[model samples]
Structure formats: structure tokens, C-alpha cells
Target: MPHKLSEIISWPEQREKAKTYFDSYGWPDNRNEAWKYTSLAHLKEGKFTASSDSAPIDSAQVIDSAAQLEGFYVEISGSAVQLPPQDALPNGISITDITADDNARAAAFTHLADNHLLPALSAMHQTSAIAIDIEKTDSAAPLPAVILNLTGSNKEGACYPFVIVRVHKGAEARIAEIHSSHAGLSCPLMVYEVADDAKLQHIRLQAEASYTTHLGLNQMQMGKNSQINSFAISMGGALSRLETHSLFLGSDAELAQSAIYLGRDRQHHDITSFVAHEIRDCASRQLIRGVLDDKARGVFQGKVRVAPDAQKTDGQQMSRALLLSRDAEADAKPELEIFADDVVCSHGATVGELDENLMFYLKSRGIAEEDARNMLIDAFLVDTLDEIEDPDFAAFMTSQINRWSLARR
Candidate 1:
């Protein structure tokens, strides 16, 4: 039986609009270019409803490794939102839970003006959101992490969670996106706005149960001279699709994105991103690596666009997947649409199994076959973590990967 939508949280106008769109256009399928690798034909028949109650979870009992690290955290289970106390936050930063105030809700929701399918579908469910704002700071040490943990229902239901992060001029912030176990039918959206001279370091860890389904999106808007460095690890969830959309509204901005994924036992993971350089002198790079075992499958679709007037724009993307078993599958599609005469953009993708020569060499050195394979796998994934600037975040991600590799053995 379908549960009821949460009554405590409501966004009447946007919910109605999303409902109308669903009634007319209907949900998209593989026919849509954006969803070519992932299909939603089965989701249309799901009996899940928006969650109707709040769940309070103990931080220590959470599954995601990021939640274990020290930080000011926000915990959300279903429609409930728990923000860090104001006194606990730094002087120049503030995070707040959304209320019924029309002006406040309207202002924070501007990021979804031209919404995507996942956000629109989330709107149909009871919506819960939080706003994060940071001002310029002169602290010598790096700012502490802000962990946003989204947990699913203990019962059978769905969850819709939203977050917005704003970095003021000349400021910087570090954020960690952590999802707990069993994020059932979850559709979450996050928006990051970086002003001129601002910076943001974002790291995400998705370690949910095998029965979970997670559909998520991250939108990035960059201004002149701003920068964003982000990394993510996807190792859980039965079906997971994460899409990142980046737009450069000003000149001289930089973006660096890197990710690692591990799939086993018939799991499905999809990562898709779109980066558009609408202005001049912007540079963006993306690096993705994954390891698959058993009958698991992985997909990566990356597209970069440069406008005619956007001179001196440079973008690069590369994706490589290492298959651990014959039954595992990997698919990649990389695209570049450049209308500018002076811009440079390129993309490349490759899928292959572990190196037999390396394995043979390791075995000749007296290492067991299983030990040699694990050693080679560790080396293949270790370099990816070098791209992460934050040591704590890197270690957290690596710890989870090691655990997963052990389980695979």
C-alpha cells in the first residue's frame, strides 16, 4: 500500500505545477538523451508515496562514513530537517531550516526556476529544504566540513530532500554529502552558487543498502574568478543515478571534478554531467574511474558545451572503468559541442578488464592470485584520491572502498 505524503511540509504552488507536468508530459524514459543510459519504465509502476513522518537517527549508527567525521551536521529523515545550532556555526556562516514564510521560501527556491525532472518529481512529494550562506572569512585554518546526511524511511515510502549553498564574494566552504542506508525512491537536488573570488570544496559519499534507489542532481553556478573542487564515491544502492549540471555565468572561473565508484552483485550506477561555458576564460576538468564485479553495470555520460562568444574556454573529461569479472558491463558516452572559434574542449572514455600482465607479474613474485588482484585494484584506485585536496575526505572515501573490496573478496 502507498503511504501518505508528509503533511507537515508543503510547497503548494510548485507541487501543483509538478503534478500538472506529470499529468501531461509524463515521466521520461531512455528515449530522452539525458536519460539514454538509464530507464524509468519501471518507476512509473512503483507504489511508493512521499514519506509521512520524521525519523531521528543516531549519528554513530549511520552507515555513510562521512557522518563519522567531526563537523557541523544536518540530519534529514523524510521531511524532517535538523540544522546545526547557530552558536555552533562560524560567525560569518548561517544555515537555516525553511519555514512557512512566503518570501524566504520564494527566495531560496529561485535555483529551481527551470527545474529538472528529478526536482520536479521531488516537488510532488512533501518537500524539505535548507539554506546555507557564507561570507568572506580570514581564518588561517581551513573551515570545518558541513555534513548533510539524507536518510530514508524505515518503512516503505519515498523521500524528497533539497539543499542550497551560497558562497559569498571572497569566501570559502567545505561540504560533505552523506546518504544513510536505504534511501528508497529518493530524489534529492542540491544547488551551489559561488560568487566572484569564492571557492567551494564538495565531497559526497553514497553508501546505502542494496535495496535502495537514489536519483540525485547537483547544480553549480559560477561567477568570475571563482573555483569549485568536488569529488564523490558511489559504492551502494541497487540503482543509482547522479547528474551534475554546471554553468559558468562569468569569466576566469575553474572547476575540477573527480569521482570513484565500486559496484558488485548486480548493482547499477550511472553518472552523467553537463558543463556549459557561457562566458570567457573558464576551465573545467572531470576524471571518473570505477571498478565493477559480478554482474554489476556502470554508465558515464559527460557533455561539455562552449558558446561562440566564450573565448579561451578550456574543458576536458575522461572516464575509465575497470571490470573485475567477465559478466560486469561498462558504458560511456562523451560529447563536446563547441561553437567558439578559440575554445578548446575534449572528452575520452575507455572500458577494460584488469591487466593480465600485471597480475602475472605479481603472482610470479609469490603473491596469491586473490592477493595480487586486490593489490592491483588498490593501485588502480589510489591515484584517483590524489585529486582530493582534503585529506580527511580522501581518507574517508578510501576507508569505505577498502571495506567494499574486502567484501568483494
Candidate 2:
């Protein structure tokens, strides 16, 4: 059952504004360049409803599953969950519910009002938002990691979860955001603001069930001399798309992003990113890898724009895919638009299959053909996993890849 727009907890004015925006644009189809390859036919026909109602959850089960994981856990069953008390946090870290501050809510609404369909819908139907603020001093002490677990229900409706992260000047923090779902739809929006001289490490893992559909957007704003390192691992969902929009608001900002995606058995995974170097002396790098098996499909579309005034920009992007089966498909579209003459920009893409010579070499060494293939696949993904700064999180991601490989075998 779909809930009325009025049932969502948004300011009347903002809701109306978002509704007007959504009505004008409506849902994008193949005609939309960004969504040309991915189809939304099932979603459009399903008429999915957005709800804040919490489903029955086994807290113990969730806790046990994450007991070995390192970090402070913030769990979301269907909607956002409560965080620990302020006093329990570190000296410079604060987690505040967005609803507590009307100004924050309004600012968030404004930032997402004109976004794509999923983000606009998220702004209109989001029930709760959590803001994490980090303030680092010159003490050089390592800040604690924050983990967000977004779990979806088996119901047929959709749930929208929103998160806001701010790294104050001179602060350094690591955040791990994970998404797991059952048999429904999920649309999540995350915003990050990195102040001057701040450093943020973000690790995202999307491991939803095969029957789920996930559409997620991550919006980032980087200030002068700020740095953001992002590593994402996508291994689940029937139809999953993760889009990132990064804007360098000030000069000397840097961004390093890498992603690994695995698709099998008719699954579809898409990773799209648009990065803007709006100022001078900014640098950005992106590396994407995909592993497809059976009849699965993978897509990577990345674009880097250097403004006319944005001189001294260094940007590079690379996309590579490995197809395990003849029916598997991989598509890569790497583009660069440079308006400045003093910039260094490059983009490359490659799609290929397993090397038969390597397979034969391993087989001659007394390894089974399946074992050799799995070993080669794992070796191919090791570089991407190495990009992660956290050893624990990298280990976790590696485990996911191994699990996928073993299951397919």
C-alpha cells in the first residue's frame, strides 16, 4: 500500500517544491542518457510505496552478524536507528538527528531538491536523517570509525534512508557504510561535506539480496586542500546502481575513488560518476573494476570536467572488466571534457576475458581448472582491495569477493 505524500515527515513547502520538481521531470527512461542502459520498467510498473513503518527485526541476529566487525555500529532495520549518547562519543565527534535542527533539515532539503528522480523522491519521502560531525585537532590521534548498516525488509514497498557527514577543518575520520536488503526496493541518499584541510576515508559495501533493487546517490563537496578517499564494493542486488557526484568547491582539493563490482546469474550492476574540477590546482583519480559471470551485465560510465578557469588540474580515470562466461557483458564509457588548456586529463577502458594461457599454466601445476580460475579472479581483484586504507574493512571486502567466487563455483 502506498502512503500519501502528506504522511512523510517533510516541511510542507519543501514537499510541495519536491513534488513540483518530480512532476516536471517524472521518472527517467531509456531516453535519459544517464539511464540508457539500465531499465526501470519493473519499478515504474510496480508503483512502489514509501513508508517509515519499522518491520520486526531480530536485534540479536544483526548484532551477532556484526560482532566480529570493527567499528561503532549504527543499524537501520527499515528506517534510521538511534545512535549512542553524545557523551559516549569521542571528544570531537557528534552524531545528531537531523530533525533536531530545523536549519539542517532545510539545508539538506535544498541540496537534494533538484537532484535525479531517486534523490528527489528521497528528499520528499525521507522519514529521518542523521548527521555526523567530526572536528579534529592537531593532536594526531586517530579517530574512531563509524559504520552504518542499512537493512531492508522483505516487504514489497520501498524505504528511503538519508545520511549527512561533515568533516570539520583539520579533522580526519574513516566511515564505513554498508547496505543489505531482503526482497524489496531501497533508495538511499548520502551527503558529505569536507572542510578545508580535512581528510575523510569512506568505504561503501552494497551486498543486497538477489531479489532486491537498489538505487543510491552519494553527493560530496570538498573544500580547499581537503581530501576524500572512497572505495566501494558491489556484489549483490538484482538491479543495482550507485551514482556519485563530486564537486571541488575550492582549490587544491583531491579525490581518490576506486570500486569493484561482481555480477552473476542475470544480475545487473552499474557504477556512474561525474566529477567537476571547478577550481585550480585540483586533482582526481578514479579506477573501476568489474567481474561478470553467467549472463550478468556490468556498466561503468565516468566523466571528468575541468572548468575553463580551473587550470593546473590533474585527472585520470580507468575502467576494466573481466567476463567469465561468453554470455556475460561489460560496457565502459570513460569521458573527459576539458575547458582549460593547462590540465592533464586521461581516460581509458578495457573489456576482456580470463587468460587461457594463465589457466593452463595453473592447471599444469596440479591445480584444478575451477580452482585456477578462482585464483586468477581473486588475483585480478587484489589491487582494488589494496586501495582501501583500513585493513579490517579491506579484509571484509575480500571475504565478500571470495564468498561470491565460491558460490559461483
Candidate No. with top lDDT? 2
Error of 1 at 331 (Å): 1.0
TM-score of each: 0.90, 0.90
Query: What are the per-residue Cα lDDT tens digits for candidate 2 across 58-128?
Result: 43443454455666777666664768778888788898877556567666644442546766777677756
Counting clashing residue pairs in each candidate, in order, gives 0, 0
The residue pairs found clashing in candidate 2 are none
Note the Cα lDDT for every prediction shown. 0.78, 0.79
- Model 2 segments more than 4 A misplaced: 1-12, 47-66, 109-115
